[model samples]
Target: MSQSLLIFAKILSPITSYLNPNTKPPTIAKRYKGKATLKLDIPQGVADLLLKGVINTDTRTYECIVEIIGDEDGSQSDTAKLVVLVAPSTPVCKIAGVAEYGQNINLTCLSEEGTPSPAYKWQSHDVNNVPRPNPPKTTDKNGILSLYNISKDTSGFYICTSTNEIRSAKCFIILAVMQPPMNKVSTCVILAAVAAVIIFGIIIFFYCCRKKNKPEEYEMGRSDEAGGKQLFCCHGIISSSRCAVTPTNNV
Candidate 1:
């Protein structure tokens, strides 16, 4: 009596085998016998088919059949499916439309490669550093977050998380709502006015200090027939006169 085995890759490509009765040695298909990764256990009726060193792209179903030669019954067969899971990669996030106040915007998040296509969740941190779900916005199944009538209060740090059955990943971006150009100009003008006031105050302080340190002056009176003179010293407009001694003894 003799027996044979057949293994199919996805039920399409077949690998045939022959079992010799007297030698107890099984012969495998020539095409698959030389493969280093392929292994066969004839006695146990097991075959390990190695697709390749890398399994990223080799996920599919496989089937196998075992039969006894000259038997009235048909061959026994089984099938199995293969699945490869990959963790979610770093997600990419983008904001569509202007981020100004009172405008609509869309935040898109995507993870290009993952096993069991990844789903997304959005989180945000406000100016107060509190974490919560993004408000005034709606997220869809495709991972798009829509913000309607945005405002300064809506600006903060946003995080996009991508997750699947395998694993999860996240990416973040900062949302800054800017004031109008005219408002910025107004702020600049206000700052400039404040600086001018400070400079004027410094100038007035120095002027007052110089005036306080000025030297006092005295006024000299005309000489009289007696050949004596009087001096008037003015201290901030309050003056007093002091008379000089008459010179008559020398004469």
Candidate 2:
């Protein structure tokens, strides 16, 4: 009849462990004649083998093996799969083109590093920090928001939220749709028009004054006894007042 002995081994070290020949050997004597003994000062439970931390470049799994030399059961081993959890980071946002009326633009959000790839959600708000009644037309996909032929109504604050199973993060940007400048009447043109009108008025006023101050001429009829003579005078009418000078002519 063969005797069977059960040996229990507890791995109590940092990340990795291995047997050292110079300090201690892991093999048992073939004939069971030699005494094989292991002293464990600090008892550590198996649950402590499962390592957990934030996911980064140095995350990996570790394995522990328990071996018995004379046991009917061969070598027995167990592996601990270490998994690191990472929360979502603040999303980076970018605008593709100028925010102007009648122009097409795109807003993009990105969460570069996360344990689980993050999803994106887009929202808009007005200048007063209130949600708009009717949001602009957009295509929400992956992490991009597209606006076609944007208008003044599309100008506002855009919020981009990135979410994962672990956590969520958000970022915001302002979309300002610029309006084309209005055409204004020039001051130079107005002043030129006013000056032209004044010059025309002055010309008309001088013409009227010249016509009013010019001298007047009159022709007077002579009596029959004066042998049918005609008279011309200046500065007075023939019948009203005496003339300063008179010119007589025969009919």
Instruction: Return the TM-score for each candidate structure.
Output: 0.57, 0.48
lDDT tens readout by residue for model 2, 58-170:
34554555444466485666656544556778989999987877888899999877666788998889877788543556788998998889888888899999998898999
TM-score of 1: 0.57
Summing lDDT over every window of 10 consecutive residues in candidate 1, give the lowest-scoring window.
231-240
lDDT, candidate 1, 175-250, per-residue tens: 8876557987799999999999999999999998887876644345444546464435444342246534344464
- Candidate 1: stretches off by over 4 Å: 11-36, 50-52, 67-73, 179-251
**For model 1, how many clashes?**
0
Best model per TM-score: 1
Q: Report lDDT per candidate.
A: 0.71, 0.64
lDDT of 2: 0.64
Badly placed stretches (over 4 Å) of model 2 are 1-15, 20-55, 59-81, 133-137, 180-251
